[model samples]
Target: MHRLLFALDPEEAHELTLRVLSLWSERGPLLEVPARLLRVEDPRLQVEALGLRFPNPLGLAAGMDKDARALGAWWALGFGFAEVGTLTPRPQEGNPRPRLFRLVEDRALINRMGFNNRGAEEVARRLWRFRERGLAFPVGVNLGKNRDTPLERAAEDYLRALQALEPYGDYFVLNVSSPNTPGLRTLQEGPFLDELLSQLRPATPKPLLLKVAPDLSWEALDQVVELCRKHGLEGLVAVNTTLERPGLQSPWAREAGGLSGRPLKGKALEVLRHLSRVEGLTLVSVGGVEGPEDVWERLKLGARLVQVYTGLVYGGPLFPRRVLKGLLKLMEAEGVRRLEEVWPPIP
Candidate 1:
């Protein structure tokens, strides 16, 4: 299944995969076999963050279900939470075709998909339907600005999306980190960040998290951490996709856009380690995480929650269950009963 999907254009494969998952979500019988094979339940894996309880610490990261199409299928696939969208105030066609590439050898993906989605109003409707049907796990909405929105007025776009979707999401992610949108990463800096957060903070009833880029300097990261604290934000989704392509073996290495998967693991971990030192901020780690050891390491390193995107492309549907089960074994070996207890171990 994975190889066949890989044979098609990356974006087409993605859409086709979503359609299958959406069908499974809409019909119970279709999910039975996969759910039994994939779902791993353990009280010890429960994690409480941002005022919501995750059945497990693992999540399906943003970009996978950008329009909230498969919210119902995620838990069946073993993810404890699912974040949807990079949804803008309005619909967008995103970047031109062939914008998504797979670096097979590197076990990574590079995409310049510029926040393609069905718009906030449309996605909010889907979210409401999911809610009406009863979501099985926590869901977050990742907010992004429209492609044509002026960088100066970017806050207005995010504010619009936030207002429309806030009632439906368990939490909200302000996505200023994606490299595909022109001038979007710039919003991570001083006044622009402050202005955007200031405008959205009061209106956001749910916990607000800022997703940041992996390419930030230590100094810039410090500023972001401080600003997050100062602004009363709930948490940080450490390290979005990276623009750097260091020591990659695939021919697709030179392709433009943010690089995710194994190539991003090292830097994403470094950024998470740095953020762990900050006293009050919650950290959700993403990037390069593929299996149980990676999830365990991130939790020990101080990530309250961990998310995956590219890992799913390579690891198949049962990946989350495998990771969760692996975590249980690790916990048993260490004689710890809870994920939180495994972290900051006694010396």
Candidate 2:
């Protein structure tokens, strides 16, 4: 069944999956069908982070359900939580076609799909409806500046989207690291990030975090972490995607935009390990998390939570349940009592 999706264009396959999930989300009870089959409801998997309680530490990374179209479906598939959007203040068609590529041999995807969505207002309404179902699932919203918005006013775009979706999300992420938008990654730099955070931090009492790129140098990452603390943000989503192709085997590896999946594991873990040294910053790790061991590695290294995108695309619907179950077995072998006790208390 998953192979059938591989036959279609990457974006087309993604759209079809979302459409099916959206229909499933409409009938709230039907979600229970998949939930019973896929969800692993164990107290040991529960985690506390970003001022919210997650059923498990695993999550669906942002950019999967860009417009909040599949909340129930994600829950049914057994994710602990889900982050939706890379939404802008306005609706956008994004860049031209062939923007998403599958690096089959590399077990990866390269997408330059620039902030495509039906805008913040529409997404917020969808989220409101999702909330009305009262599923107890935590939903995060990732905010991005529109493609046409200049770098100077980038903070305004973020603030506008956050304002629109504030009440609807359990947490909000400032997405300044996507390579698809011209100069978007610049927002991760010292001056730009400091300015952006200053404008955004005070706007809401919700857990506000920043998403960063994997291409940053250690010095640059330090600057990002400093600003995040200075502005009183909650935590960070440790990576967006990589611009570097590394040692890819697929012909499309050279495509522009960001590269995700197996190749990103090394750098993503490197970034998470570096950030883990920081005392108060909560870390949500992503990139190349293909199995239970990857999730366990992040949690052990002080990442309070972890998310997956490319892994899910390749692993099919049962991936979350299988990984979570495997995580339990791994934890039992290591003598872990609970996810909260995975690491010593951060000072």
Candidate 3:
């Protein structure tokens, strides 16, 4: 069923994928997988990050569901948590079509989708309705500025999205990392970032996570860490996606967009390890994480939690659960008990 998706164009594949997820939601949670099979060996998999308890560290990354429309289905499939949206303040057609290219050889993808979604207002409505009834798992909203929004007005874009979805999300992710948006990365610079966060705090009451790119330099990362600490932000997702194409073996690697998958593993870990050195910030590791070993490595590098996206595209629905199960076994083999013990030590 997965390979068949490879044959379709990226947009078609995405639509079909959402349809399948919608169908899954109708059937409800499949609890037959058994809690024991889902347990990691450490037995202490639960941790409070961003004021929320994650059953385990592995979660589904944002962009898979831009609108928070499939939270229930994702939880049923066994992800510990799910992030939705790179949602904007207004609906966007999101760049030209053919923006998403798959690099099957390297199990990677390059997407310049431009933060496409139904905007914060509609998404918030759906999310509020979902929460008013029930939720399958915790959901975080990954907020972004619109493609037409100018650089100076960027804070307003983020502020609008944040205020709209603040009530519905388990957490809020400030996405200043996507390469598709022009000038968005510049927002990561010290002064610009400080202004953005300063303006955001006035309206947002939720735990905030700043999603950064793997392409940052050592100095840039240091600035980010300081800014996050200064603002009392809840955590940092170690990466968004990369613009680099090194180590890729796929035909699609040449496509222009942010690259994500197995090729990104090493750099992502390096960033996580770097962030781990910080005293108070929580790090949510992402990028190139494919299985249990990667999850274990991220935890050891100071990531309180980790998220998977490309792995699911290449490994399918069973992947998250499989990673969690394998992670437990690895933890047992290493004689680690509490999950927090795996956090990266101060350098």
Top-lDDT candidate index: 2
Q: Mark the regions of model 2 whose C-alpha exceeds 4 Å error after superposition.
A: none
**lDDT per residue as tens, model 3, 207-235:** 88899999999999999889988888878
Q: Model 3: how far is 224 from its true place, Å?
A: 1.4
| Cα-based lDDT for every prediction | 0.90, 0.92, 0.83
lDDT of 1 at 100: 93
Give one digit per residue, the lDDT tens place, for model 2 in 1-347.
79999999999999999999889888767779768988999999999888889999999999999999889999988999999999999999999998999999998999999989999999999999888888999999999999888999998999999999999999999999999999999999898999999999999999999999989999999988889888999898988899898999999988998999999999999999899889778899999999999999999889999999999999998999999999999999999899887777755
Please provide TM-scores, in order, for all candidate models, with all chains considered together: 0.97, 0.99, 0.93
- Please report, as a residue range, the 10-residue window in candidate 2 with the lowest summed lDDT: 338-347
What ranges in model 3 sit over 4 Å off? 29-43, 344-347
Write one digit per residue (lDDT tens) for candidate 1, span 1-347. 87899889999999999998888888766666667777898899998778888999999999999998887789788899999989999999999988999998999999999999999999999989889976568998999999888989999999999999989999999999999999999999988999998888889768999999999999998998888888899899987999999899998899899999998999999998888788777789999999999999999899999999999999987788888999999989989898868555211
TM-score-superior candidate, 1 or 2: 2
Give the per-residue Cα lDDT of candidate 1 at 327: 92
Ranking by lDDT: 2, 1, 3
Better of 1 and 2 by lDDT: 2
Candidate 3 lDDT for residue 111: 93
